[model samples]
Target: MSEARLPTLFIPHGGGPCFFMEPPRGMPDPWKSLGDHLRGIGATIGQQPRAVLVVSGHWEESQPTVTAAAAPPLIYDYYGFPPHTYQLRYPAPGAPRLAAEIRLRLDQAGIPSTGDDIRGFDHGVFIPFLLIYPDANIPIVQLSLLASLDPAAHLAVGRALQPLRDEGVLIVGSGLSFHNLRGFFTEDPRIAADAESFDQWLTQAVTDPDPARREAALTAWAMAPGARTSHPREEHLLPLMVAAGAAGEDAGTLTYRDHIFGKAVSSYRFG
Candidate 1:
């Protein structure tokens, strides 16, 4: 018999492409714990995954789309980093076959889907993979967040992709838990406080046994203390909805948690 299906993850992708290089930079603190936390993400899976499907908050489209390349290229999507950072590479092979499987699954589930054979792995997809599957051996495909950014629609997309979990595919939502770019360093107490309040609320929401409570928490998520200030726009936060949908009644666990620039942030693993 095959092993049990692995849990899905909603991780804070961290800043830029720094996580992939020798030592991370730009944060006020050393981020030692965060680095260690990222390295340990693969161990919980118990074995190597056949393919990884990422729903990146960074890649949004007018409609839901998936990367369909057999051997997708790597994209250096960030700017203003050091000169050497541009030369970094992960070189993971893409999974065209698995991409077809994803398209088929989503189609059958009544979720309209499209694929781009030439699309490469953006930072959202590559950064996390560089840490979890550093060998770049596992096949990877990325799913774009739809333009609407509706939490419900993303959840629907997750439900459509759930069957892939049984086929040894690890589904991950790659986005930062806190992403208010302007507020990150503005010396504004409101930003920090709001981010913290929303973070606490999210933790409780995912941990709750009651579906109604979880739904309520998610719906009201924008109201949490510094919710809008931290998110400004909700693309990054939307990926969480997809992960939660894939979780399917399983309770979520706090896999990683920390603060950036004195603002609270966290990551979750849902079985």
Candidate 2:
């Protein structure tokens, strides 16, 4: 454990290898703003964390699971990307001890969890991070989202992991605030409006001064304005729940906001 207490974050890991590969069909670098935002994360945190406990939208299991490999591999979960993206390396070591502690915390909280020695970091973990922590020096361990995708359960998962923050672990939720593939790719004019509508609601909920009210708002997120349109499936947005739960009484602030593929997106920081 280190001396610095790290803030919890909900970051938008851009769509599949978007950071490395060229934008499709001459689209103006869709990831520029997001990539820049990610690059600034290291400095924004003030100090390097001893380890990072990440929750990604791409991985899920019947119960909560944490990566346990001493030297975890990259999963290259995305397909049809440029070959270089597959070869991209982020040789960050695995924090096996941290993984063990995760399971212990979950168990103590009555939330069943296990560890996997085989699974690797998915695109959601390695992609945006390629910029955030370019040195690849800090250890990272991934925790799987519950297969049930129950919001409250995920918040509980975050709460269980919150104690690690005091021990110098940086808790991060890596997923998009707006994740509608159809709306993103299609030529519909309503996409931006719909995304913004939901983005505003999410910002309000995440930044709510009252911790209880914030959690309640997030628990019932699907009812928010354009919530379904912003997230047809809540997997991408669920990571925010984890970050918020870990935050405890810390109020959230919107650290980044932008439009990609004409859809509004956002990121949050909580201390």
Candidate 3:
């Protein structure tokens, strides 16, 4: 509801290029709900942003890294999709100045950072963004996750980048709440139950009124209900830490939640 400052977001970037491709023979369109949720984002925010700083689950580096290219190309990181999906274009300009500012902020905070001028926008940024900002009007710069994959480390990263929100930059963490490749294809009902169990725990943790307790719960997220079953690896869940950390005193609201590929997935917004 705050207009002067933009909120931080933790969103599901969808499975690969699922948005551009059709669903399998008998399956109902699995991407609709998430896609619609994404499409409504521009209106939800209530104004245009100077740029978007995205931390995608797909990109990881030795240190915290930012894409410093002026015009970053799309990196079709996903595979086994239609050829046209590879041909999809976002054409959003890259924000090198903002990237440099990010590096500066991280360094000021004693967080060693680097920049990659050649790296392109991976599927995590382009896929959901093709729906979120179709015209590619807003500039974007991607921040790579630390190779350590430590939850508290990412939270620190978010805190380092929080000032960008007041400077008209939208901070978004692109990753699914529930991401298990094996669970996505499995037909057993237990997976759904497991995802929901994790989802419930995640909702409670993020929405907690006490910010200190919220961060503590997120830092120790691996022990939450159905945590391991929801994410065999922790990469997909770590982005939420960054978003939550940037939130400062603001509490998070569950903006979107649904069962896709039979797993409960959700998105969060913090202002």
Candidate 4:
């Protein structure tokens, strides 16, 4: 008999490579806890995946696209970090065959998509994969977020990629849950309060037993408290829409969640 299909995840990946290198000085308890939870994600999956396809918020394009590189290069996109971070490498092999399969799958699902053989794994893809699949043996590919950043469109992207689950592809959306960088260092009570409120609403919405309500909350997420504050720009949150959309009729489980940087941030998995 075949194994049970695995779930797709949308993880709030904290600041670049910091979680793995070492807890930064003066890092908040919640941020530290969030890092610990990322380590736990691998164990929770119950088994290693044959391959992974991540929809990283960091990579965006005018049209829907997927990365097909057989040997993905490292992208040191962040600045002001330790030199080792720039040298840090996950070295995971890419799955070109899988990339073509993704493009075909999307087309079959009525979603037009292009494939790239030379795309590299950006921080959003590399950092999380380094933690979740540390061995770097699993073949990986990353899909790009469309320029629209529209929740519905992202969900549609997920819907198109849903078949990958049955094929042993672990789909992940790499982004932060509470992603207001400027507000992260602020002492303002209102910012923290609003982030918590919005996170709570998001947690409830994603875990709702009713599919319609879950979809509604995601659709109207821009209205949630601190929505603009937490997101500023919505790319990070957009990946969740794709994860949720791939989840389809099921309201995906919140496999891991925590408030990082003293603000509620979250990660999720959907089957």
lDDT, residue 259, model 2 = 84
Question: What tens digits encode model 1's per-residue C-alpha lDDT throughout 1-271?
Answer: 1267877899887778766455436534435567677789898789788888888888888777888887888888899888877786878878888878887887898887888978898888887777778898888889999898777788778778877788888899988788988877777887788888888878888888875567557756787766787798999998888888787777788888888778887999888
User: What are the runs in model 3 whose C-alpha is more than 4 Å off?
Assistant: 1-3
Off by over 4 Å in 2: 24-27
Candidate 4 Cα errors over 4 Å, as ranges:
23-30
- Model 1 misplaced stretches (Cα beyond 4 Å): 20-29
lDDT of 4 by residue, 1-271 (tens): 1276778888877787776565547754445676677778888877778888888879999878888778989888888887888887798999989889888877887878898877798899888777778889999988999998888888878888877787788888899888888888888888999898888888888998887788888989999877888889999999898888888776667766665556777778776
lDDT for each candidate structure: 0.81, 0.92, 0.92, 0.82
Residues 1-271, model 3: lDDT tens digits: 2258899999999989988778789978999999999999989997899999999999999999999999999998887877888789999999999999999999998999999999999999999999999999899999999899999999999998888888999999999999999998898898889899999999999999898999999999999889999999988888899999899988899999988977889999998
Q: What residue pairs are clashing in model 1? A: 194-226
Q: What does the lDDT come to for candidate 1?
A: 0.81
Ten-residue region with minimum lDDT total, candidate 3 = 1-10
